[model samples]
Target chain A: MKPLLDLSVYLVLGPQDCPGQDPVDIATAAATSGASVIQLRDKRGTTREQVQLAQRLMTALEPLNVPLIVNDRIDVALAVNADGVHVGQEDMDASKVRELIGPDKLLGLSVSTQSELDAADLEACDYLGIGACFPTISKDDAAQVGMQNFRHLTEQATLPVVGIGGISLANAAQVISAGADGVAVISAICGAPDVSAATKELSSIVAARKDLG
Target chain B: MKPLLDLSVYLVLGPQDCPGQDPVDIATAAATSGASVIQLRDKRGTTREQVQLAQRLMTALEPLNVPLIVNDRIDVALAVNADGVHVGQEDMDASKVRELIGPDKLLGLSVSTQSELDAADLEACDYLGIGACFPTISKDDAAQVGMQNFRHLTEQATLPVVGIGGISLANAAQVISAGADGVAVISAICGAPDVSAATKELSSIVAARKDLG
Candidate 1:
């Protein structure tokens, strides 16, 4: 599958309380509002529960045609028939995943270093997700890849590149200008009081940049 | 959970035609003969097929108390109730996986460089699966870490370290002498004609190191 050229926002859902965040609700809201890719990333849930949630989210986002990516889960993704699966630097090897999923399905790899990029068969993958642009509570142990790494890697990648981790509207443009094809936001969209409004504003940033070419 | 200390002989499965050997049958034979860890490393299946194979392998190996480590699918590992999941530098973040799967599950991360080793949090993981101690075709892009990198990382890790990628009984002692808790093999025990005998010899090597203290 050819990767989308527009900036894709990955909505991160943290559980309720610790500052009033809701993952499913936020993702639903983001999808309805126009987030290109709505990925479910709740790392702490039973397989049954995670699959059910992914199914519901896949159904919820169907109308928008916004791809639902199950974070680090091939089973849940396959069970839910999600649009794709997002694996990290410590997840499954992308080439192996591509072989398992076939060439038509989208398989994304999280790369934090140049060696990983060199190691991957770019032809087999749809895109590369680079991240933690800023430290975020979503993944505390995310490596310090920094914005420069983002720019360099994205520029170097043969496939589309999505920037993840702690991304918000405030820095989305900078990440895009840094050469990322898309920006995957977690807390920024999920935590917004009005997800629809937040997505509209974020989407417009990517949409408005078409004239830059 | 504390890792099993006495367990030895890491066996990996490979494809039949490639690398002039078959990894799956080798791994199966090794498991039947009492190998400690049997890893399914087929990088050629789709997500659905991979999960199915993992499920089948888990069922096959469960009776022997042999831990089945999936090459890189935490979701598949969780799906199959696999003993654990092994990942490389291009996979998911190990700490994130620990959070997703909880502390009780086993999470092993692959390390090929001193930088990656130094960056990883020793406390978050159950063990370190280090490797490609020599050149081999089990993995197409196997990065030869040389003996020095192996020695350096294993010495620094507080957790049990398993050497992987092209490890054979011929030089299994080198990995152990370097402070590795175990050595992971791909085509070694898996492709041998007398699988049981191959594993027994490898196990003895891992065992003979008792005098190292």
Candidate 2:
């Protein structure tokens, strides 16, 4: 088993999601302010950009002792020696990804459906992200897995769980209260006018929930 | 060794390049009209879209006997059981891609510079894509390797060579005459008003050049 991550305020940002600001700067700010984990999910850039930016991100986050997770593209994750890789149902199977990524690197699998959650090989990934806890703009097709389903799935997950998709400051506490280790958010922090402040607020919320528990 | 492909008109199309038309429709038309190979280079769609579309493309082209090569994303290629995969200098290392895809699947590596060509592990891939034979739009960053340099690389290359970038009916024969087996094109066939006519014309040019040789 991999070392457990704090999972609180897991910020998922990319070139496509960052808009006008540089992703590195956004990630740097989020990391320093309290984001425990960072995931690079660039859906719009070229393969070169993905690899290059990920290298930069690894360097940026290394000193902070925070882990950088690559979304979907294991090539970039392996090339950059990132902390982990997160895959959806459509990407390479968790078992194959684990075999290729090997034992040391962290692996995260997203489970949006009960069958998918039920069928996920327990040995493949270090953690599970269950969502769309609410409607999400990032993945418009994601079936709304409502808070009730999110709680149910989290209860059944063998590994640590995080709430993904459409999570924000307004309701991030709800995700933790429902028994997840953290909330994986995109726009709430990446699109925030003040990224650092947004991250601090979100992290405190999850930290507080864990403290309460 | 992977079987040497009939390199005549290699059509590189993707959801991003096909514009108003469905990528499948465009690929089918080009394949039937004489495109010897088809590579899906989608830098735009989601991972699910990439895999699902590539699967549909494989079924569509299997009967026509054209190979479907996925660009950059090896996971999609492996998931869909694609005939092959094409990678650029920035994607996964050719040797590593070869290692994962194994011996049977065709592997193509793109070399835009002399250093990349010189360092390329010749035994790793079945073929190489060399170019921006002219100023090409598909990848604006591709270095413009004029015909002189393109021919030099092709001559030095141990594997079959295909000219990629800015190739069209007007300039494809030049690529063939330059010693490359075929022209790997994107906009010329995918963006053409008549996809079938464009493919037939481009394929004939390559065939004619080989005949003259």
TM-score of chain B of 2: 0.97
lDDT of candidate model 1 versus the reference:
0.72
Predictions' DockQ, in order: 0.06, 0.28
- Pick by lDDT: which candidate is best? 2
Candidate 1 chain A: worst-modelled 10 consecutive residues by lDDT = A13-22
Predicted model with the maximum TM-score: 2
**lDDT tens readout by residue for model 2, A52-120:** 899999999999988999999877787687899999987777887787678988899999889999899
Q: List, residue by residue over B1-213, the lDDT tens digit for candidate 2.
A: 354487788988888897778999999999999999999988766677787899999999989989999999887887787899999987877887777688999999999889999999879888999998999888877989899999999999988899998998899889998999999999998888899998888878899999997
Alpha-carbon shift of residue A11 in model 2 (angstroms): 3.4
- Among residues 3 or more apart in sequence or in different chains, the pairs in candidate 2 whose N, CA or C atoms overlap within 3 Å are none
lDDT of 1 by residue, A1-213 (tens): 634434456564534312554456677778877787876775655445676678778777777777777777776676666777778766666766665465556777888789988887777677888876777776877876898877888789988888887778888887778878778876677666778899989888866653463
